[model samples]
Structure formats: structure tokens, C-alpha cells
Target chain A: MTRILPALAVAVTLSSFGSFTASADPLPSWVSSGTKDQIVEFVTAVTTPDSTDYVTPADRIAVFDNDGTLWAEQPVYFQFIFAMDRLAELAKQDPSILTTPTLQAAAKGDLETVLQGGHNALIEVVNASHSGISVEAFQAAVADWLDTARHPETNLPYDQMTYQPMVELLRYLRDEGFQTYIVSGGGLHFMRVFAEEAYGIPPEQILGTYANTTYEQVDGVPTVIKAPGIAFIDDKGGKPINIERTIGKRPILAGGNSDGDFAMMEWTSAGEGPRLGVLIHHTDAAREWAYDRESPIGKLVDGLDKGPGMGWVIVDMAQDWSRIYTGAN
Target chain B: MTRILPALAVAVTLSSFGSFTASADPLPSWVSSGTKDQIVEFVTAVTTPDSTDYVTPADRIAVFDNDGTLWAEQPVYFQFIFAMDRLAELAKQDPSILTTPTLQAAAKGDLETVLQGGHNALIEVVNASHSGISVEAFQAAVADWLDTARHPETNLPYDQMTYQPMVELLRYLRDEGFQTYIVSGGGLHFMRVFAEEAYGIPPEQILGTYANTTYEQVDGVPTVIKAPGIAFIDDKGGKPINIERTIGKRPILAGGNSDGDFAMMEWTSAGEGPRLGVLIHHTDAAREWAYDRESPIGKLVDGLDKGPGMGWVIVDMAQDWSRIYTGAN
Candidate 1:
């Protein structure tokens, strides 16, 4: 574990042109108050060696839940949107899957109908579209799709649509020697395939939902074939357990934006040592979209009610964040 | 990210009984002549920044096969031995299992009979014992068992019975900025529970076979409940895919001592740059048993045949290494 912070030069960017213009500073729009001060103070107190809240580098683990917290999850969860597109493409050949309730729902672009039976039905469709292919072929296919896939509403390429502040936050925390991990309700394999290219997070460092895959020797060459089973579900309550199971060390910092992340933030706040939990409230109605409590996507009203008791930091997106997306680079 | 290499004093035999032992050079005993020379040469060549073969520190990845490369897997693999012990202890409650053909065969302790069906049956016993348990409970159980579990022939605690030379080798390479990973055929969850305590390697760096597991909300607590299915088989050809899939870099250094590891070394050697492959040939019949080709456990005939042609360094246990087990305190 070597710190190369001093050796590497800090990159300074002054507003580059793209889908969205870069500002002089990322937090221009964020309203400052005790809320912002608390966050900055917390990070300073824990990270500084002299502070009472100073934590050793080993204990300085931070985890972030993706989707709504880091990026736009409108129209539907981005992955579900991708899966739906994939399902529609596959529906051309397998017309019979449309007869099945789950596949029929997905093909009909009905979220309730598709998620009706849940696990069994979703697995059937995922297996139909995602499995029985070589890993290389799968990776290339995903790469190609990701290169061209644009969000239906935002018209932003999915990758570019990431929250700029969170990306900067990830880099800033890493600069302070905190190992960052993404503990999401997303597919581990899919996230892993893009983590390095998209976020600089490596596969081994990324923990999420998974399926059992096998490696086989065929025609004197080795190939890994995806198996037909669910291995781990890294959503909701499973977040903390997966973090424990995979990383061993409990994170001192955790961030999220939904009830699905409530357990994670709860676990992080209750940890014995110094901890930080940040919740991104969907209050930005103009740029992106906003919904909570009654909405299906990223509901977090309970989280806000329960957060203060647990020492979680709630960031009203409208006031606390200056920027929304990173835009295309 | 502090590079504590200077502070990480190497372990040596303590001069008397002081808590702080005088540090020996973290370097190994093998004189830079044959195998050791080849290894050091390859590592140096690849890591030299100005050289044509120079690889970045990120690319200076090294993978090792655990079973034969790091420890003994003679009469039976240690984990299987642990499984056998677990099964026998459980047999008291279900005595009929002891008399049943499968359980009787298992209890008799003849590994051939115990694994009569194949790897799937082996996993069947393992899953029941390892899954649905608290992470702490599983870890404590492993630590407790390792404290007392001894090889039948040597009667030494399996933990202390690890290959001392290889242990030193790991430190030596790590000191030189090589990130080492243990690629093994053992159960992933099982190995993960103990790898850090036994080997000083982080859980994130350990790759192995796994069974299916799921996340569950139990009494409002998040738990990864083990499911009844095979996930990934991190053995043979699977080793390379797992390495590439997990590590995302071609190793500059690789080591193993079995046909199961041949694919891993081949994958390493196939890269178009300076790289080293080492096969640990157990040749000390006096200190321990030795077998290859015909042996079910730790077979190395294929690795031996292809090693020289592939520019791999084969280290004969009795010849290249001066010490067998240092029994590091």
C-alpha cells in the first residue's frame, strides 16, 4: 500500500466544452449551511491524523450505492431499461417468450407485469438473453451496446449521465486513502465489465449481485461459461452483508439515495469507529427528475426520517449539489 | 496508501524470546543461480521503467495456486480434511449417515470412496457445512479448527505446515511492488474466511471455487444466505478466466505445482512480455510425501513437461529451497 498522492500532479480542468459545460468549481449551485459544513467537517475530522475522529487508512473504507445516488434512474432503472431493450431484441426470435407472463410484461414495456413473479421469471428471461454465450462475445456485445445506447428521456449516453459531484467525490475520497467500493443492487458481472472503463474501480473491488459461472476446456482452449443459478443478491439489506462477506472490513463511509440503501447507511452509521453516511435527496426537479416516498424509483422518505437518528447525512439535491451530470467527455 | 515497505521489517527467527524479533532480510535463501535467478531476472526486467519489457506497477500482477504451490495437499487436501472432520463430527447425530453407503464410505476416511461421485458431491457436503452461517461464526470456526487441525503424517498444525520458502517468496515479491493473488481450487467462501489470518493476503485478493448464495433479510439484519447450487469452479482452465476476470491484468509472475495450475501459467507465459512461471516440485520424501502424474492430489507432470519450453522456472523442493517450513510466529 503505497501513497503516490504527493508524486502525482493534481489535474486541473477549467470548463471544457461538451454535452454540458464544466463550471469553475463543481459545487457552484450547492447552497452552503450547517448541512454542507457538517459534511466537510466530518471528512476533515476523520481523515486528518490529528483529529479525535482520525481513522487509520485501513479503516477508511467508503462504499457508494450506484443508480439513483450516482446517476439518473428515470424512465426505469437503467439496467432494467437495458435488459428490456435486450429482451425486445431477443423477442424477435423467441416469440414464445412473449406468451410467458414475465417476458410478456418486459416485451410490453410494463414494469409491474415484468416484475410480477420476481426472481424465477426474471432469471428465465436473463438466462435466455444473457447466457449460453462466450465471455468474449458477451463483453464485446455489451461494449458495443454501451457505446451507442442513449437514455430515452435524457438523450445523454448512459455513462456520461453520471452525477459529476459523485465522480469528483470518489476521486477526492480515494486521494485521502479511503478505498472506495460500489455496493449496489445491480448485477455484479455487468457492473464489473464496465467499472474499470467507466469509474476506474476494478472488478475485484466491486461487489454486487451474481450468478454462478463455470470454466470449461473446449477444443484445447479455455473458456468461462455462465452457469444457470443465482449466487448472491446485493440489494437492500444484503448490502451490508455483502460488504462484510467480500471486503471483511466494515466501511467507515457509505452513500445512497433510497430505502434500498437505508440498511447500508444504517450499518455504516452503527459501526464502532468513525463513520459517514450521505443520502442524496431527489429534489432537483429541473435538470434530472425527482420523486420520493410515493414514487416507485428511488423512494427515500423513510430514509430521511430514520437518518438523523443514525447520523446519516441527508443532502437535498436541490440545495446541496451544484451540478447533476458529468456530461460527455 | 503509505508505502510502509521500509517499516515492514522482515521476519526472522527471534534472538531469544522478545516480542519484537530482529528483522532478517526479507529476501529468500536460494542463491541467484538457477530458478531464483530466472524469477528475479523476469521480475526485474518487466518492472524496469525504462526497459522495453517494463510493465507498470498496475501490470506487475502475480498469481499463485494455493493447494500445492503454497502448502501440502498429499493424502487429502486440507479443506477436504476439514470437511471430513466436520462430517464425522456431524455423524454422531445422524449415525445412519455413518452406515449409509455414501456416509459410510465418507466416514471410513478413504478419500476415493468419500469423493466417489466427483466434485459435485464434494461440494454437496461443503455447502451444508459452510452456508447460512454468520460470517464471524464461520471465521471463528475456521480459526479454531486451524489452531488444532494437524496433518495425519506430520502431526503439525496445518497452518504451521505451510511451505516456508514460498511464504518468504510472497513477501519478497510483494516488497518489489508485485501485487500477489492466490488462485485456488478450494471453496471461495471457505478460503475467504481464513486466507487473511493464515496467509496475510487480503480476502479481496483471494480467488477460489464457490457455491451459489443469496441475500436475505433476517430479523432486519442483512445476511448472505448460502444457496444449494454450484457457482464457479476456480480450478484448471477456470483459473485463467477467474484471474483475468478478477484481476484484469496479465501476470508478470506466476507460480503453481499442479496440472490444475498449468493453464494459469500458460496464460501468464502467453503474454507478449517478460514474465516468469514457477512450479514447486515437492521432492523431499524424508520430510514429506512426494507424488506427481499418478497422484490425484497436486499432480505436476504437465507443468513439468511444458515448463522449460515455456521459459518457466521449476523449483525442486529438496534442491532449490533450503528451508521447508520456518513456522513463522
Candidate 2:
């Protein structure tokens, strides 16, 4: 789609911050002279008219990876945790549902056993917990879990575990005429349950790994029921492919924390004209959980090594963020 | 995703009509006593605050079918015609590419023979013409086709065959805070090429049938190239399923011209609160080509038989539309 300039630019500011003033800093949670400066510089260069890097508002598309980029992904992905909890809940009602060894391990909260079984095992756990229900019911289940469930370590609500500075950045980008989308490896239905409230991104803008669904008429009402199979996994190479398939335009900016997002960042960086690839490096142990290259979940080896050489910005959480979780002590 | 009302509403109107006024009419191409009045009444009921049928702006999503709903699908689907032309162009370069009978028939413009070969044959013709190119290159090819390809019967550019009243309807809905989307069985990439230019809808808002794609690094640049396999067909039951998977919300209104879109209208009508299902009955044989119920292309059996009984607005193109093509005499 060839987009025209200026006409697509509307004053529909999505800043959670109050009306922007000349002196008001949009990203108040970000410390100066680090990732904040990099972001500001890139946005200004692309948005400022008469600059060679100027991009039209219609082409100002930005994508973000959810788990470790926008929020904390320690121990394991939050969606994986949600699946475990849901499996346990489902098993309590009908113990026979826990047939497979992976399902049994996941339902019993034996994370060690489930993790030992590998990626296929994790997918089994997710499919068992996530499927065989109506899309609305599954979303309701997720919403219910988020309402009561708390992180084992921080005890913070999963939705509230989102990074304060990252949320601020999302809002800041939207204010700069960029359409921000969450292109993550999280389950599409799982993320859609709380993404709008958590990150100010709508469900339509949230693209992620999804399960196969079948449309059926239940009780005289048209319904889409989740089925027991993975449709597409929006991770690694799949990220860029899904983005192109859905958005049809190469995003100008991409953000992620793990190697799973490397393909998306690479794709964005390779696009013509002004581009920015942001990688959030986990370095703030005291404020937020810190794990990087060797971490089982959200391992950052590729990003840490290759991102900078690709002119991508690697954000140091310890040095760049003045705040971690929103309103955290 | 559960949407919070009034807050989501913004003044991001996409009206090509100068400005809204009490005396100014929005649908000038539509005759007032028919489907236009049905649409106006429904929109007014849902949008007016304090009304019994009032709905939030966030829930005001309307979907339209492309081939026959938004434009004319006379002799056959326009995309099929595009495929035939594209196959001819490709065969001109490499004769061996036309190995199959379907390909040969399509390249030679023998529509009768191609049609006799059935749906699989059409798919073969399409996949052969549409794949093996970078997404950008394929879109460029489509743009080129729309620029030069004229509808054989009308001698008008293919893009110009769009209905003016439907265009106005899309803009009016957007002006009233509805997010209008094209949910068609037409090729996703093909529609995205001209959808924004012809209908004011961005690529992200268009959902349709898509081919399998592969991500590869071509000359060190990340590229998505179309492959020769049908990934998902966005028609019939697939329409509602795709909508649920992609948008994660049931649309409030759906407009289509045939039974292929029946599932979409059914899904929209079954949603809670104010709903509308619009079926465009092609009845203008004098002004425009018209066929229904028995026409192989855009056969309208289910929509004609059950739509009115379901409270769906059956738009009589002859009576309801004062004009067919945007600028046609």
C-alpha cells in the first residue's frame, strides 16, 4: 500500500500523559543519555519535515515484542505460566483430561518436568489448556486468571508487570504519529484479554502465535471455537513473515528483548530510509529481574552480539530506566 | 478484547465529503426510500446516545465483501480475470510455465474452458500467476494491472468499477466512528494493492484469502516471497473464523453480495446489541450487469432467500442505487 504524506496524520494522540507541552518530556520514566536519547533522536529524525529521513505518518509503523520487551519474562513466559495454571484448573474438574506426560506435569505444577520435555511438550501443555472452548470463554478464562493470579516472585499482577518506561515509549510513539502494534510470541487470545488495558494497544493491532479455530453454530449463535492445534508461531523467522502477511508493509521500527525477535528487528533495519531497531537488555537486577544471554526464557545472545552492529539500539535497563514496573517501590 | 466506550471514540473521520452538516446529505448516490434508509436508521439508532439501541463507538465495526459487495463481479471475479491476464503475461516470457490445461486455458482467455475445469483449476491458475515473487514485486504487478487493465465489457479501468454509493457508505460509517474493513474472498495481496487508493481503507483493514509465504534473505535484505499454496481461504465459514482470529471481535455490521458472504452476515447478526446485515442484490441489468441465484459468479441464493427474513437490508441495485460505478453515465 502506497501511503501519502500529512493527510494520514491526525491529532489522535494516545498519550497517557497529559496534553503535550513544548517542555513536557513524553517518556518521563526513561533516564537521559542512553536508550532514551537514541529513541528521541530516531523519532525526531524520521518525523521532522525537511529532514532526509522524514517518513509519512501512514508509513510510521512500529512493532514490539510483548513478553520481555514490554514486560518481565523471567522463570518463563507469562503465557506459559497462564497455561500451567489453566491446565491445573481444568484437571481438577476432570482428572482424565491430563492424559499426556507433559499435560500431567503441567497440570501438577511440576515445571521442571515440563521444561525438561522441550518445546513440543510446552505446546502440548498450551494446546490442552487453551483449546476445546469457545474463543469468548477462553478469553474470559484468561481475564479471570489475570484478575486473581500473581507472579510467584514479585507477587505483582501479570498485567501490572509491564515495564513502565516501555509503556511510556509505546504512548510516545503513538503521539509521534506511529501506529504501535504488539507482535509477540504470546497466544493471540491470551494477549488480547488484557493487552488493551495493559499496553493501550487494541486486539486488532496485537498479532501473535495463534491456535487453529473452527467456526460453528452453537445454541443458534455463531461462535468460533478454539481447536487443539497450533496454527502459526509468531517467533524467530515467523515474526517477519507474519508481519508482512498481516500488515503488508515493512515496519520502520521494531522492538524486542530476545533472539526470538531478531528476525523482526533485522527486517525493520533492512527497510529503506529511516529505521530503528530497539532491543531491551535486561540489566536491572535490583529493580527488575535481570537475566540475559544464558537465560532459558528470553535469551539475548544474538541481540546482544548482532543488534548494535546492525545500527540497532540495545537498551540497558539498569542505566536507562528510572522506573521499572509502573508505580513500583 | 473488551473495549471501553466513549474513551475509544476520537474525531478521526475519514470522510471525503467536505464536512458533516444537518442539511448536507452523505449518500447522494443512493435513492432515499430503499437500502439507504435502512442503513441510516440502523446507524442512527446505534450511534445516538441515550437511545434504546445505543452502542459504543468501539463496537461499531463494519465489514464488506469486495468482489461483488464493494464492486462489480460481472462475468467472473475480477481477481480471476487478473490471474488470467497475469498468466498470459508470464507465458509470453516462458511457454513452459503453461504446463497445465488450466494454465493454458487461462492464458488464452478461454473462460468457458477454465470455468468447466472447476474451482481447483481456478486455484491453479491463481497460484501460478500470483506466487514466486517478493511481496513488494507482486503488489507492484497488481498496481500496474489496475493502472492499465480495463474491464472488457465496460472499457473502464478495473479500479474505477468500484461502487460510488458503497464508497460513500464506507466513509459515512468511518465518520460515525465505525472501523470499516474489507472482508472478502478476493486475494489479500491483490486487494491491498488498490483498496486504500480506491476505498480509503488501509491494508491492515483488508482481510482476504492468502497464499503461503516464505521469509528469506535476498541479497542480504529480509524479504517475504509468495509461495504456490493456499494458506487460508477467507470465504463462507472461513470469513467469520478469520475475523475472529484477526480482529478478535464480532463486527456490528456486514455487507456482501452473495452466499459466500453468508457466514459473515450471520456472524455479525448474532452479535449482542445493535446489529445489521446488508446484502447487495444486483438487480440493475440496464445500467449495470445483473444476475443472481443462478449466476456462477457471486451466486446469491442464501442471501436472497433468508436475508430479508433475518432483518437484513436487501439492497436492490436498480432501485436503491442511482449510480453504479463512481463516475459512470
Candidate 3:
């Protein structure tokens, strides 16, 4: 706790430096061309007190999709990795899980078999790995997994796999008085574990897919037990619905990668104001994995085709981002 | 929006004056010698940088139950009034509603008949009045009702029925860098209509019971259609459950006034380190309605009995408050 002060002081100093140079380069990781200008122009217009597009600080909500938009989700969604890891650990504890067909398929990295189970199979995997445990216990498990988990391709800690340009954009938005939130398709509990540490966004500001939880007293201790059922799915149409129910306001700015975020972008752009819709087009095969319409996971075909018509900025990751991963170019 | 600047300046000036006189009176509406002291002490210890109980600004989450804790709930919860009002209005437009026995009873102010219909009946009424409408339409309806509706007993607007002391406490907490959230059993849309204007808390910070909603393109226009079903109930055990699901952290400070709040307080207090639980006991029959321990609505028996043992401050409304309603004694 004491060490946190010096780190905070350094962050404050860095932030002050960023603010001073905001007009010149708030998003240093972003190229000084293309969508960068649009982002800066939109942010400036909304933040200027006398500008017609100026929005109040309270209403300056900006939502970002976690997976491909903020971090690399190619190969597979990070939460799926977490789920698979949990299955392996469980198999070690109770060898019976290794024999279970679906669990066995998951353990062998046979994603095709797992997906064949369809939505129900996916829910089964999520429940088996994520639920029937106390929330505190789940959080601890996630924290421990995150501390050690690394991306198979990069061998970097999963948190370090976050996009540098998007990280800068989040910081710039916050500095410009916008409340940034992670409206993700990933599990809420999983996102909460590292949201603050990785993204500098608090857990409360992160809304994601969730499971039903029951409150019970266990030996005079109050505990929230995560149940084996989906409470909400924050994808496609569900994104906009969950945002409205949880945040109670439409975001002024929304960014996502896949077609799943199409409704969210539409809902945001439909608002009667100066709204910005950003779609991250993953086209950087050299720096990162490249997938679009043909990909099974995080398909971006619909959003890409609709981007121009909807006035959404399609960020060409290969062109717009000067840097990809946090510490890599 | 321009007018807000001067008003904010005035509030800043007033707050400075209050700070200088903080030792004498920080909460003028609250009695000088009561739970007020405990609240101030807890806030001071947590906000102080060097104190062992120090909490970062980001972690200073303070949850408040809306109905009985922050505002009056006697003569029935205010939302019930809104629901009944909506029923009457709908009955005027469509005479068919008159044939619905429960709605007819609600329109006639026959709460006995309405309650006899049980939880399912209550859900039906909520969906009838709140759902099957666009989110924007429902918000407008709530706004219109709040603009004209008055408490049957006090003859004051429902928003004005809020406790002056609690208002002060909210302001005080905000001044000390605590983010305040309204975790209520009332409808989320209903609460959002007036939460910002009445409490200075933004709609984004307000969480409440909500109905299922669907995102649809109504005539090619993106709209969220409120669905006919209870999505979440934010009361009793539900309070803690929603808090965890939404906020993803245990509140350090929690205030409520019913048996429904018992689990919320327990969950909040169960967290490690400095915590404060406050139960607003309705004991002021003269200044405000007084019915606890056996009241049908906002029952306080379990909470009141266990408050002292849990180190929760049970606020006796008669003795603890110098003023009850905002701008009234």
C-alpha cells in the first residue's frame, strides 16, 4: 500500500505531461494520420466548453469492447483460455473431470468439439469452470491464473497483450473527462480481476456477460454463490440492452472489432448528438494475427461493410497503429 | 447548462464555509450528538493518507438504499404510487384496463386487493405499466409523473420527500471523494428519471430493479424495447447480489432501513478493514411516519435487532434528525 503512493505520484506526473502535450500527441502509439485525426477532433469538439458538440462531463460516456478492441482476441478469446486452464486444474484435483466428454475435449484443446456442443455446451463449460463457488474464491482463482498466464504465441503475460494505441485512447478519453467503460462479451468476473490493473478502468465501470449469483450465509459469513446459469449476454443486440440497463445512458463514443458490436455501434450512433463509432479492423498479420469475415471467432464482416454507411471510423490496425502490443512494436 | 456554473460556484463557496465550521457542524440537519459523529470519524480516518484505514479514492464506494434510507417510504413506496398513477392514466386511455381486476384495484387505491395478488401480481403490474414501451417513452412517462405527483400524506413532491440529513451526508461523502450509488429495489428507469436532479447522483451511478429489454430496429430506427418480465429484483439478498454483479466490490459504507437491507449490510460489513453500516430507524411519528419492527412496507425488525451487535449505527429518526424532509422540519 505504501509503495502505491510513489507509483501513483509517477502516474500523475506522466498524466500531467500527457495533458500538456494532448493537442500535439495524446495518442502517441497511434499514427499521426487517418482515424487519429478523427478521434482527436471528436474528443476536442465534445470537451470544448463553448463548442456546439460539447457534452457535460457526466454524459461523456465512452464504451470499449474488451477482447479484440482493447487486447488481442485472435486464436481464441482470452476468457476461453482461462476457462480451459480452470478445466485442467479441476481435472488435476478430481480426475473424474478428465473422463467427462466435454471436459475431456476442452482439456485436449479440441475447440471444434467444444463448439459443436453449441451455446449449451459453452454454457456448460463456463458453469463448470466459473460457477458453484463463492465469488471471493473465484476472484482469487482468477487473480492467481492471471498472475501466471501467458499468451502462447507471444509468451507475454496476458495483460501485456493489450493494444498500446487503445490504451492511449482510453487514457486520453479519461483525461478529456469521459468515463470509459469496458462493455465486453467476456465474463464480468474474469474482466473485473484485471480491468483496473490492465486498463486503469475500475471494476464497476466494466459491464460484461454475467452469471446468476445467490446470496447465502455460510457459517455466519455472507457469501455470494455464483450459480450455473447465464444472467446476461453482452453481445450483438445484448450489448446495447445491457448498456442501457446498467449504465442508464447511451455512450457518446463506442469502439468494437467484431460484427457482435454492430448493434452497440448502431445504438450509440442513433443518439441525437455528436457520436463517434470506431471499429478496429484487425489487418496486421505481421505484428499480430489478422482475421476478418472468414474467421470463426471475432468475425468482423458485417461491421466492416456497414462502417462507411454508418459513419463509423474503421481503424486499419496495420496502418493506424504505430505500435501493437504494450511493449512491442 | 451555463446557469449550472454559477450555482456550482455558490455550492463551492458554501462548502468551504461548512468545512471551516466542520468541527461544530458538518451535518446541520443531523443532531450534533449522534450517529453523525461516527460517520464523520469513519470518513476522516479513511480519507486521511497516513491512516491505517486509508482507502484510495477509486475504492471509496458508498452504497445507499433509496426508499427508506434516503427518502420517505411510508404510506407505501413511492414507485408503487407511480405504478398506480400509470394504471389510472392508462385506464383513462384504454377502458379495457378497467376490466383487469388487479389494475382496477390499483387505480382505485385499493392496495389490499393489489397486494393479495402476490409477487406475480406485482410483477404483472410492473410489466404492464413499465414495459411494452420504448425506453425513451418510459423515461418520459416517469418524468411527467414526477413533475405532477405528490405524496398523499405530506403533499410534497416525491423527490422533495428525501431526508435533508441524508442529502447532506451524500454531499459530504462526495466532497470527501466517495462515489455514491443508489442501490434500490425501485425500477431502474423510474429512479434514473429524477436521481440526477434530486440527488446530484448521475443516472450511471444509480442501480435498481429492472425489466428485460430487447434491442430492435423499429422501422429501421434503433430502439430498446422494454420486455414484459422482471429481469432483476434489487432488494433483500438481491441488493448484495446486484452490487457484486454491477459494482464488483463490497461497499465500505452501506445505509438502508429495512429487513431487506440486512443482507446488504451483512455483505458490506463482512469485508476486510474499516466498514460502516447504518440503518435508518423510523421512530419519528411527529415529524415523519413511524412504523418499524412490524411494518408491511420497509420492515426494520431484523436489521434493528442486529444493528448494535454488528456495530451498525441505528439512526433513530426522532432523536437523530433535527430536520426530516428537505427544506422542512
Model 2: docking quality category: medium
TM-score (C-alpha) between model 2 and the true structure: 0.93
Candidates sorted on lDDT, descending? 2, 3, 1
A120-180 in candidate 3: lDDT tens per residue? 6666777788888998899899999888988888998888899999999999999899999
Q: Name the better of 1 and 3 by lDDT.
A: 3
Least accurate 10 contiguous residues by lDDT in model 1 chain B: B9-18
Rank list by DockQ:
3, 2, 1
Report the error of model 1 at residue B288, Å: 2.8
Q: What is the DockQ score of candidate 2, to 2 decimals?
A: 0.65
lDDT of 2 by residue, A25-76 (tens): 9899888876788899999999999889999999999999999999888788
Candidate 3: residue B89 Cα off by (Å): 1.3
Kindly report the interface RMSD of candidate 1, rounded to 1 decimal.
3.7
Q: Candidate 1's residue-wise lDDT over B92-170, tens digit each?
A: 6766545446555565566787666676556656654566665556667777788788778878888776777788788
Query: Which regions in candidate 3 have their CA more than 4 angstroms from the true location?
Result: A1-24, A98-100, B1-24, B118-120
Using TM-score as the measure, what is the rank order of every candidate, best first? 2, 3, 1
TM-score of chain A of each: 0.85, 0.93, 0.91
Residue A149 local lDDT, model 2:
89
- Model 2, C-alpha of A119: deviation from truth (Å): 1.2
Pick the TM-score winner: 2
User: lDDT of each model, Cα atoms only?
Assistant: 0.73, 0.90, 0.88
Instruction: Give the higher-lDDT candidate: 2 or 3.
Output: 2
